[model samples]
Target: MKFPKVQLALVQMRDAGSKTASIAAATTWIERAAAEGAQVICLQELFATCYPCQAEDHTMFDLAESIPGPTTDALAELARRLEVVIVCPMFEKRAAGVYHNTVAVLDADGTIAGIYRKMHIPDDPLYYEKFYFTPGDAGQPRASVGPDKPNGFNVISTRYAKLGVGICWDQWYPEAARLFALAGADILLYPTAIGWIDEEKEEFGAGQLDAWMTSMRAHAIANGIFVGAPNRVGIEGRVEFWGNSFIVSPRGEVIAKANSADDAIVTAECSLEEMDVVRTHWPFLRDRRVDAYGDLTRRFID
Candidate 1:
């Protein structure tokens, strides 16, 4: 099967307060990318507002909106006008007290294509995602050790490509990436907000960033698929986001990368042909012993 050679744009931007400013910035970036011939564009996570997970304030809930609400509507219109597929991540308010970290996909025709909720909610220091988001039930088990098993991966097909959307913390897990690849995703897209804590900046920031990039690159190599990460830039509260948004080829090469602290659009052209070529050369998928990996369902072997 032959797929089109798709051009992807990763919009790396700083947090903004008003929807107007964020949308404006996104418009400019999208226009720039479209002029450069990008067919698919993705923005950083929570691009419309500052990373609210920084501190738990009930008032932050006001930022949440429905799928077809103002933000998505505007993005869908822009996508149709530009004739590009747009992936917009939003803070979703499903109900009064229920919310999720969701990414809405707008097709080239300006229609709402699909929505993928963040399944992994991290509750680490400086990142309090679990306090606000209800981890997405991808119809899977919550615990690896339990009798219940996760359905593996959630896959979505866009007008341009078969995509797998995962949020910030989800980027750290190989299980998520592998499952997405196994489910037939041609591209793994991660809308992220990873950064350095004020105190950790001097001690381990560089190492942390290196590890992050290394992991994503490994995902591309292991899965034989293109991987793209659109991360936020600039400082917000106790965290200083390390932009460095990038696109990696199926060969695990960094084709395009943005600056660590700049708002820029990184574009890369991915050929589905390359994925097939790489996978054929390195048959990781063909060699997988699925029937012998039941221990992966456990949290820890010990």
Candidate 2:
């Protein structure tokens, strides 16, 4: 398979205190990236509002909005004008009491290409995602939504790339990464909002950041796919969001990365063709022991 070099862009910025302000800030960064030849752009997780799951407050749910809401509508228009593919991750109000951490993939023409609800929900201190989001289900892959297929995962196909979309916590799971790659996605994008809690920063900060990067990079190397992580920067409440947003190659090389302290538009040119060459040489996919992996479906082998 042949593909042209695509400019991948990550808008790494601080929470703008409000959704309107954040969107405006992101739009500026995106415009700058597009002017510099970015074809596909991504924002950090829940870019429209502040990271609200820090506490279990019921008011936080107010941040969740339905699809085609204000945020998506604005981004869709921007995407159409910019003629770029925009990966907009949001706090989705799926229904009255149901919500999700989802990414709406908007095509260059402003139409929604597809959406991938985040599959992994975490419930750790200062990061209580499970309280607000329902675990995403990729019901009956490739099947249309119906009684047979409750809520199937749709393949996000855009003009510049086929996206394997995941949210913050989802980035830590290898199964999700492999499934995305197997689904024929060329790049794995994790729109993130991970950071260090004030107390743990001095003790486990360095190792924490390294482990985060290594996990995603390992996913890229194992699946022979490109990976882009756009994490938020600056401080919010008790957590300091160490940005360091990055783009890694199929070979696990950090091709482009942002700083840990400021807002920036990090861009990298992905040689999509390199995936085929790398996969052919590595042959990990071709050598998978599918018949011997039935145990993987279980929670554990007790």
Each model's C-alpha lDDT?
0.87, 0.89
Residue lDDT tens for model 1, 45-100: 98888898977788888889987789998999999999999989989887789998
lDDT of 2 by residue, 127-173 (tens): 98889999776655454743212233334778988888888988999
Model 2 clashing residue pairs (backbone): none
Report the error of model 2 at residue 286, Å.
0.8
**Every candidate's CA RMSD:** 4.1, 2.2
Give model 1's clash tally: 1
The candidate that achieves the highest lDDT relative to the unseen native structure:
2
Worst 10 residues of 1 by lDDT: 143-152
Among the numbered candidates, top TM-score falls to 2
Per-residue lDDT of 71 in model 2: 88
Off by over 4 Å in 2: 1-3, 145-154
